[model samples]
Target: MILLQVQNVERLFGSDVLFERVNLDVQENSRIALVGRNGVGKSTLIKMIVGLQSPDNGQITKNKNMTIGYLAQDNGLNSSNSIYAEMLTVFNDLKKMEIKMHELENEIATFDHLTQSQTKYDTLLSSYDQLTHNFKEANGYGYESEIRAVLHGFRFYEEDFSTIIGTLSGGQKTRLALAKLLLEKNDLLILDEPTNHLDIETLSWLEGYLQSYSGALLIISHDRYFLDKISKEVYELTSSGTDHYQGNYSFYIQEKAKRFQQKMKQYEKQQEEIEKLEDFVARNIVRASTTKRAQSRRKQLEKINRLERPTDGQQEPHFQFTAERQSGNIVLSVANAFIGHDDKPISGPINIDLRKHQMMAIVGSNGIGKSTLLKSILNKIPLISGEYSFGTNVDTGYYDQELKNLHANKTVLNELWDDHPTTPEKDIRSILGSFLFSGDDVKKVVHNLSGGEKARLLLTKLAFNHDNFLIFDEPTNHLDIDSKEVLEEALLNYNGTVLFISHDRYFINKVATSVLEISKNGSQLYLGDYDYYVDKKEEQLLLAQEENKQTGEIVSKQPEKNSYQLTKEQQRQERKLRREVEDIENQLEQLNAKEEEIQNQMTLPEVYSNLQKSTELQESLKKTQDKISDLEDSWEEKSMELEKFD
Candidate 1:
């Protein structure tokens, strides 16, 4: 069944047309991810869908009895209420029903004899029982427990629940709002960057919860991994309008490229035909022998509709960062480093070496001293007892999240002008335009700019500067998916030594050649990328589990054959085959796991009997079968390679 339909929707902000002739149909239990650059009207479209804002033209229709829960970018939660009290608001109607049921039960129990009053009491009792049944069916009995579990998953402790929301930090409040949205049972859930304030654990928990949730979900997020894990369809909001692709983010990218290539080919073919027709008409129109034929061709040409070629000018930007000079092997070093503020020790006795052409990520929770460590490295803060050194010829560029260096009183154009006094005005304007500060927007005061705009400006400066070594703190904080992609591509292509702090897993995975994790215990180094870290962490967890099972001795798994130890040609072939097999196996495991989970859920009498939930699960089961078929074909090829090796 169609959950919601948006038909020919046109939205206008003042005289500017945000979107026009937009049509979309959201199906029940569909998982759609909205992606675009900032200020592309993604939020406005969502607002229109939820009836919070009206479109200038067109209509939005929803199925009767459908419910929606929207979590906005700016969490609109009152600061005076406690977290627990705020979440409890979702159950207000159910609580009222429960109270009425209890009152009726008490009255029914007070009747002594089988009189007319007792019959009326019995009738009341029956009505109360039905209401109570619905309350329980809605999971009202464990509602508070569910809320607590969600809160805990989002990094809220029992002790933090009673604290006034006004006292909590901005990130903490956003998390609280996310917790409320997740706990509320609704037919459709719209979440915008819900993972922005979430940690690794909380993100994992949310992934699991959403995988199991029965509602339709529309999420807008820059976290590629999150979108890959949850989204089945990708809705790309572009300058023209929204384009729909029937797959996750990765699949969408591949399919979109293929489509663009096909469109280009067709456009070229059509242009060639049109050119041939026009040349024939021009050369032969006045000839006595060919006048009739030329007139016929002219008529056909008049009726022909030209095809418009696909364009991605807004999506594509050429990003190149020039380096001033090469850095020494030892880019930066810290020995016995002890740093803190107010005499409190954040981290100390730290030893690390950052080398040339190396990219490192410093990862930890909020307020855990990741930023503090960066400041100490830059000598912005005093190191109590440590010897730090930078290798010769290292020109450092620092990108702080606070944007403290930006002049608030200056306009965007003036800000760039002040920094690059020698740069031509037109060149400065072009640079600003690349960062999406175009037209009259360049005249906006720096202080009035949004967080995303400020971040873009800072990054633009960092890119334009000639620095061999870069240090960034929370660089991906307010960037949209497109801007994040641009930054990721630029960094991946950069030759400079880079060390940055980021909470974005996708960015870290793409750029970090090494990872430095800081914990309460101490800091540890990982020699590879984010995926390698995850694999090592999983191995450690399994090892710990085995150790717990056996009292004293460690039970370690035996190592598999090392393909690297083989001959050069054999090793290359082995690596290729292994990667292919791993990809297939991963797909197979995901599909099998989803099938089993769905089957188990459907086996429950209540779930199987529900019209909406049952149908949605059944459709998902069919999609799983299709996925398995594709995986089987890939696995067969890998199996053939294994046979040849044997």
Candidate 2:
């Protein structure tokens, strides 16, 4: 079942073609990623598929029964309802069924007392039973649980559920909108930049949730790690046309390289043959004996389908970081620092010993002061407590996530040239060109540049600084995937140390030699990349759980008890807990099986038509479900206790 098909799609702006000959098919349960450089019209293509816009040259086909959920980059929930109420709107149909079932139950009860009309009584009972069955089949009984689970995944808590939609921030509203869309469970989910406001923890949760999703997903995101996890195939839109890759983002990279090499080889071979034929024709056309043969060869040349020269897709910015001088072994040191603003500490008592050539990534949940800590070190904000220092002769360059250092009124050329007054205008233009600003682009004011352009301009300044140490806050924020790769490569090759804060797990994994996990209380250092930090964090959590378990055991025991007796008692307790866990698990499984069997039996024609038999089965299913619920509770308690011993 193809949920959506885009055939020979083309979009044009005036006389200029944006893209042409685009074709893609989204089958049932497809996981796809749409990737391209900035300004490549990926969002425009999504609009065409969702019927928000029409293609200029071709058609988009969708199944008549198919429903689409589209979340644009800037869209948010618009409602006067509370947060939880807004989410509940997605289940209005189920709610209506529930209300009708209640009404039916009351009416059936009233009719049960009237023995004067037996046929009407039987009819009421049958309708009530049918409605009950439909309610259960529609998951009317458990829709609230589903809502709660999704709300929690999006970082919305029970206490915040009652907050009015109008009171929420724009980002929070956007997140809620996404939560509502996920609850809708449409046939196809088309998301443009779904990873926009998510931190790494939430991103991980979203990845896990989408992995088991039952419908098709079409995502446009610059988060490469996310694309690798959520996408099964990739469609890369380019100015010339669209290219399809049959794998995840990682595979797409490798496969794209292989294809590019093959194309280049074919093009080179064809060019060599063309050159030889043209030379032969030019030399022999004037000679009478070979003129006929030359004419025949010329016709053959005209028939040839000339291959276009292979290119590296769109022109991406080139980045290179070269240090003018090397600093001492110790590049930066922070001692027991408290970082925040307005004489208050939001996070810290932080410590860092950044050494030369070590790219350390600072990571934490959003709003944990990761960026503030960097600002504190850079003297942009006052440190509430403690101190930091740079090593001997170490110069630092900073890349602010907000681009606060850029002057709004300055032209792109002046922004760089002002910093290097001695540099010639031509030389400054050359540097700006490498960063993808050329001619009229150089004259654009800093205030008018897009986020990507501003980011590129900032990088241009940083690259020119030639400092021994660099500190960045969310350097990958506005960069496309291609530009991020370029920045990563530049940093990896630079002979300097870096300490940066990033929510991009992929960027951190690529560039960081160490990871600093920060919290409101303090910070801890892991001597490896992002992946290593996660593994070590998990290990630490397990150790803490085990230690807490041991402490509980010690506190429960009497001091007078002998060691051997305590050990024997502990072992016996563990065995008893394990047995209880296993027993509860088995009982729950049996009860679930019985409940399913009853539901299945009720669906049969012979049983549903017979009121008494259907009623009996429903009663049995209710009992089985109640028993399953109790056993599930017991299973969870016993399992937790058993885990403590392990």
Candidate 3:
């Protein structure tokens, strides 16, 4: 079943067509990734699908009875309720049913010997039974446990459940909103950059959860690893529209490249044929000997339609880092260092050495001071203790994750030109254009630029400076997936020492020659890329788990028993119990409908006017009501015992 479809969707901003004739479908349990470069309308198109924004032309069709849950990038959740209370609100209807179940119980007991007693008792009994069945079907008894499981998966401790949501940080609030959406259990879930601020352990837990998610997922994310793990299909949105691919991100890249190459070859071949036909027509159309052939060829040329080359107009940025001078073999060294602020150390008791041309990536949990370490090494702030030194002839260039080096008041043109005043005006403009800031875009003020644009501007400056040593802090923070690849290529090709902090595992895998895992316990080095670090970490974990198991300190989840493989006697008992429950439920539904009919008849003048007839109906209703009450007690007992076995 198709849950959602976008048919010929079009969007425009001030006459600039972002994407048009876009078509895609999300089938039952589909996992799709929407990807494009910055400012290419992936987000806008998603907004259209969710109805937050409407398309200029065409329609977004969602199936009847469909429910959708959307989580936008950095959308802060606002609520006065505590964390646990806020999550409970997702099941408000279930809570109401729970209250109704109790109310019906009270009403049923009070109607014992009243006039038209049987009719009233039957009505109450029927309401109670139906309400009880609905309550269990809605999972009212298990909601709290589900909530706890999701909270733990997102790294929320039980103690924090009582904290007011308003007191939480922005990232925490975002996470809470995501948890609420997951519990909503909608038919379709759309998440934009859901991996923001999540650490490796939490990310691992989330990956497992999403892999088994029952609903369809349409995600927009820059985390390549996450996309590779979750997406079964990829939608590559471009200037023309979205192009669908039948596999994960890695597969999409290879297949898309192959497609383009094939298209290019076919286009060239067709062009050669057309050229030959045109040459014959032009040269021989008026000649007596070959006029008939020339005329036929001219007609063929008119009938032919030209093939277009498969290239989106958007230009990929070129980032090249060239060293100005050779640095000493020891580019940087920190001796017995403690790195932090004025009061206390955030990390260290450390020692590190970087060679002339080594690219080292810093990895750590949030607030473990990866950025602070970078600042300390640059001598921008005083180190808490010990000392550090840079080797001779090392001209360091810095890329602040915050982009604090750029003057906010300056325009994009002057942001670069002001740094190199002696450079030609057109040269600076050309560099800005290289980063996709062309024409009027360079006239925008620095403060008005998007995070991605600011990052590009910074890179433009860094490239022009030609420094031999580079230090970056979260350099891939705001870059789209394409820009990240470009930056990775630049860093890999640069012949200089680099020490940067990043949580982009894909980027680290592509560029880092070494990894430094930093924590309060100090820093440890892994002499390879991100995968090697993960493998080594997993090895240590497996050994720890083995030791714990031998010491009787390990506990595992108790999986439910498989019913199909049960012993013959057990299967007989299980079958009998299941049939009993189903029989009771069906009987209760029929009795409720009959009881409602009796009450409606008693209220009419036709039956109420005739007291003898009313008395006869009442007696019949009483017997039915009494039987239902007995069944209710039986159901309760059976349900309790079933829970134990289940």
Candidate 4:
């Protein structure tokens, strides 16, 4: 089914047309990425689709009963309710149904002995059965599990469930909003820059989830790696209008390049033809023998249709970093460093060395204190423990992920000009223009700038700072795809040492010569890029699991009494213990599921209306939960014993 269709859509801003003749259809399972540079009307088009804005021409049709969920760049999920409580709101219907089931159960218990009461009970029971079936179909039993899975995927810990939504930081709030929207299960999900707050792990998980999502998806993101993984189709909105591609980001890149080559060739060919005709006309017009031919040639020239050249083929921001002086061989050293707040240190015992000109990427789950570590190194924040020092002559510049260094009240022109007090105004303006802030754009207040604009402004400052070493936190957070690529190139070509924290896997792969994995266990070095780290981690995990399985099997055999082997009776007992552990784990899972089912049934009208039955079922559910808890404990103990085999 086509969930949405837009035809002949045209949007205008005053006299200027933003886009025209825009057309597309979203099927029930469509996965589309709407992409372009920053100001190409992508957001406006998305707004039009969501009914937040209206098109000046044509129509957009949404299927009847279609539900759409839109996650803007910043979802702004601000609420006083706790995170878990907010999530439960998505299943309010299920909650109400569960209440109905319990009420029916309570009523059915009132009269059960007499023949008339039996008929009444049966009717109530029938209703209860139907309600229960609906509850099950709606996944009342699994909704909490779904909530937990999404929360975990978004990197929210169990402890965060009870935290008030308003207490969360901006990124956390955005993530929470995304989590709620996912659970809403709309017919179509449209996200604008959904990758913003996501770390690499969360990003990978989201990609996997969205790939299997039942609803159609239309996402606007600049994360190439993310786009490559999630989008099956691409819609690029250039200033010229919307262009469609039938593949992922990589395919889009390849196909786009091919088209560019094709257009360039055609344009060159047409230009040559025009030149030849013009030359013939110029020479022949002066000669009386060919005056008629010249007139014919001139007419042909006038009739010729010319193709407008493609606009600079998507201009990338010009980025370059020049180190004023070289640093020592060992650019940075850290010893047993613990970083975080003064009261609560987040990660510890970190030791790492960064050599001169080495682009080292610090990567890990979000909130693992990557930014905190950078701040500690920069002396903006005190290290909770251990020591870190930069080598001799290492002048450092920092790009704060939050752009806290920027003076919000200052104009863009003043921001850069203030940094370099003596520089000529013309030179500063030229520099700003190179970063894409042209003419009156530089007069915009820093605080009013978009995230991408702020990022560009920061880069403009970093460019002229002439620092020998640079530390950046989430540098690619708000940059568009083209800007990211340019920044990647600039870092790759940079002569200075770089230590940066970024969740962008593509950016990490492009810029990093080495990678550091930061976790609660501290820093571990990877000699290569993101892919290498992932491959090595997967190999280690497989090796560990394989070792555990092999150890379990090897020790399971019965044998005569010996130092290395158990007696037959002892072997039997050991085998029994292992089997008991496995049985308990399985029982825990079954019991949990059963507990949830009973709990969901209790909420039906018939069940809850009958006080006796509702009470009995509640008792049963409590018993099941207790059994599950006991089995879980036993499973853990036995699993630990089995682990001793390895």
TM-score of 4: 0.79
Scanning candidate 1 in windows of ten residues, the lowest lDDT window is 557-566
lDDT for position 534 in model 4: 72
- Model 3 C-alpha lDDT versus the unseen true structure: 0.84
Q: Each prediction's Cα lDDT score?
A: 0.80, 0.86, 0.84, 0.84
RMSD of 2: 15.4
> Across residues 1-646, which tens digit of lDDT does each residue of candidate 2 receive?
8888888999999999999999899999999999988888999999888888999998888899999999999688889999999999999998898888888888876664545588877888888888888889877888888888788778887788899999888888889989999999999999999888888877876875786687999999989988877787899898777889767787688778978999999999999999989998999999999999889889989999999999955788897998899999998899999887788788878999999999999999888899888888888787899999999889999999999989999999999999999999998999899999998999999999999999999999999889989999999999999899999999999988999999899999999999998988899999999878976866665566577688875342322322222243444565457446645654564566568778899999999999999999988888888888888888888878866655
TM-score of every candidate relative to the true structure: 0.81, 0.84, 0.80, 0.79
Predicted candidate 1 versus true structure: per-residue lDDT over 360-460, tens digit per residue:
99876666678888888888887767779999899999999888868889998888888889999999889888887789989999999998889887777
> Where is model 1 more than 4 Å wrong at Cα?
13-15, 93-135, 313-317, 420-444, 552-646
lDDT of 4 by residue, 241-280 (tens): 6788777777778778978898989988989989999999
lDDT of 2 at 112: 46
- Among the numbered candidates, top TM-score falls to 2
Name the runs in model 4 displaced over 4 angstroms: 78-81, 99-131, 157-159, 163-168, 312-315, 407-414, 417-425, 442-448, 550-646
Question: Which candidate has the highest lDDT of all?
Answer: 2
Tens-digit per-residue lDDT, 176-216, candidate 3: 89999999988999999999978765676677578668899
Candidate closer to the true structure by lDDT (higher is better), 2 or 3: 2
Ranking by TM-score: 2, 1, 3, 4
In terms of TM-score, which candidate is stronger, 2 or 3? 2
